[model samples]
Target: MGTAQAAQAAQTTQTAQTAQAAQTTQSAQAPQTANAADPGMEQAPIAYVGGMPPVMDHMIYSHALLDEFEARADGHGGQFRYDGQAWFGTDYDKLWLKSEGTVGTDGRFGDGDHEALYDHAISRYFDVQSGVRVDLDNGPTRAWGAVGVEGLALYFFQLEATTYFSDRGAAARLQGSYDLLLTNRLILQPQVEMNVYSTNDRARGNGRGLSDIDTGLRLRYEWHRKIAPYLGVTYTSSFDQAASMARTRGRQVHALTVTAGLRLWF
Candidate 1:
């Protein structure tokens, strides 16, 4: 072909190519541009409401069990151990404010012992607990203090340590527990508690300042919608300064307790 003819043909081809490119671009973006009004959804922008209703539920129960044992020196003195517990909770957002406490009576029908467990959850599975207990000792009042993190991995395991202070002296205990689910209605909880006492308290002959070994198995069966019957057998013994006091007051005493109680929740 002639130079002028070839130039004309090339220009025509270029024009056709440009038109095709423009059409392809428009086709590719048409659906998106048209759907801008609907945004491919029929719902409006939803903002999570900032408020949730507070949950209020509380339970009160009493347990009547035989509390009898033989001390090395005291020997064959039996008393009934009665315990009562109650809890109240208020939840806001993700925080739960709770106050729970227990009161127990000795066999002699004297002033009962009491302890309160304070718990606040900053987030799911992370909570702080403060515990204080007062005993019926004739002298200065007995109290306990504790602060720890719970649920490091999951809700099945917990670690906590407590320091006890009283007119007599001071002591500390570190405890860890793991809950194993055996069935829908049954669970096994294994716990380890280590006790330590200050020199002054140990010297004063405080029973709890010495070392203690407690290993136990606890099982619960739900009998009603809000109540469960629980049983536990624990092997408990004391050592060191506490053990020495027990021996002088009374051998290393070994005893086992079989506890049957009702656990109720609302």
Candidate 2:
């Protein structure tokens, strides 16, 4: 099993799959919390769905010098997010992981459909992560970010922590992705991701008590080169009892967003 100690589960690594199940797993297991304006920014929408559970054994290793810009709707509020991630791997299992950070600006309406950002604000933050995969007789399994000592793919759990100006907390993510290869060059992937918030903005009496879920699916044709690109659709949803309360208290939200984008690796 290969697990990185300092990788953020939010970062993605472009890995080709060999089948539909793997494609579906890759799409279903990614984080989608950021954007709607840019095609490259919008990935799987599951990152904002709030209460969905993390998928198992999914990991994305990002380049150390890459950045992404994204825009999306948060419930009724529109926001833009930007992220950058870098990766490192060890010889042990060829295990690779990445670190990521993000910043967001809001442009959504206020409580009464008034001017956008009337009472809302923009913020910036960063997170740390790590992940690993395991090979088993029954199946290939893994864990990312703070993987505990249980289950068949004991090393596939993903971990993340965010520290913002007004809110600071940590979350544990579980996800897995596999692929279906079509002639060794064509493939389909599915992914699932679950996010559990260990802390929320408890100060100033604001914040949802918990976190959300994110998932994705994608298909691609690989040329067996140093760089590859692919296209796919994504879905997102959220769940948190505390978030409900925060909504009731007049917070900004969008609830859902569907997007398309390309995936690349070198």
Candidate 3:
């Protein structure tokens, strides 16, 4: 009987050791299984370092209306001219600069209108801008307050309209343009612009109401997206008192010009 009891106790001790070994192995694997099931180990979105936005969030663009390179008999005998605009910032906010005019053969630039403005987007496709305008020509060098809206219309048309108030008088301007693709690299563009005044500035040969209209059609082959050479025709006409005023100054009320120019951006 004594031998049998000793044998039974030995058997019980071996079974308990086996059970402990199994428990120990399971405990060793517990952390690894928990990590495999953890939600924190899943894929995550990219995190911006140093709490800063991406670099490509801002943009800059510019273009020039290199008009009048080849012009017909206009007001002043022979002149070189350029009209350009550039802006910098995000799509919703920007600083804008625009200038257009002519420099005579005598190496002087007098006929021009320029502005510097702050642009604020009021909608996805529209911005309201306010700034100052400076006019130079046969008239006095005048400075004016400018307010305007510029944006896209009808999904593609680019449009801008501005009103000006100055010590001399009030004025408004409208500019619009549309682009048509003739080929993958060839494009046709048409533009129209108008100027109106509340009062006539005889010194500047401007009418009290509708002063002038400028219309142009251009065809361009873009050698590259950043640069294009264009050839176009421009028609400028003066009306009412403005036309009579130009005649008095020995200038024609209408001028037709051929335009050749390069439009570039960086």
Query: Which candidate number has the best lDDT?
Result: 3
The global Cα lDDT (0 to 1) of model 2 is 0.38
Supply the global lDDT for candidate 3: 0.82
134-222: candidate 2 lDDT, tens digit per residue: 11112222222243211123243322332222124344445455566766777776655455554543322223433554455556666
Off by over 4 Å in 2: 1-86, 93-97, 100-170, 202-210, 245-256
- Sort every candidate by lDDT, greatest first: 3, 1, 2
Clashing pairs in 1: 72-250, 73-250
Model 2's TM-score against the true structure: 0.40
Question: lDDT of each structure?
Answer: 0.53, 0.38, 0.82
**How high is each candidate's TM-score?**
0.53, 0.40, 0.74
Q: Count backbone clashes in candidate 3.
A: 2
Location of the lowest summed lDDT over 10 successive residues in candidate 2: 112-121
Clash totals in order: 2, 82, 2
lDDT of 1 at 187: 64
What stretches of model 3 exceed 4 Å from their correct place? 1-45, 48-77, 137-139
Per TM-score, what order, best first? 3, 1, 2
Please provide, for model 1 over 98-151, each residue's C-alpha lDDT reduced to its tens digit, 9 standing for 90 to 100.
Answer: 222222233233223455666666666565666666654333444555444444
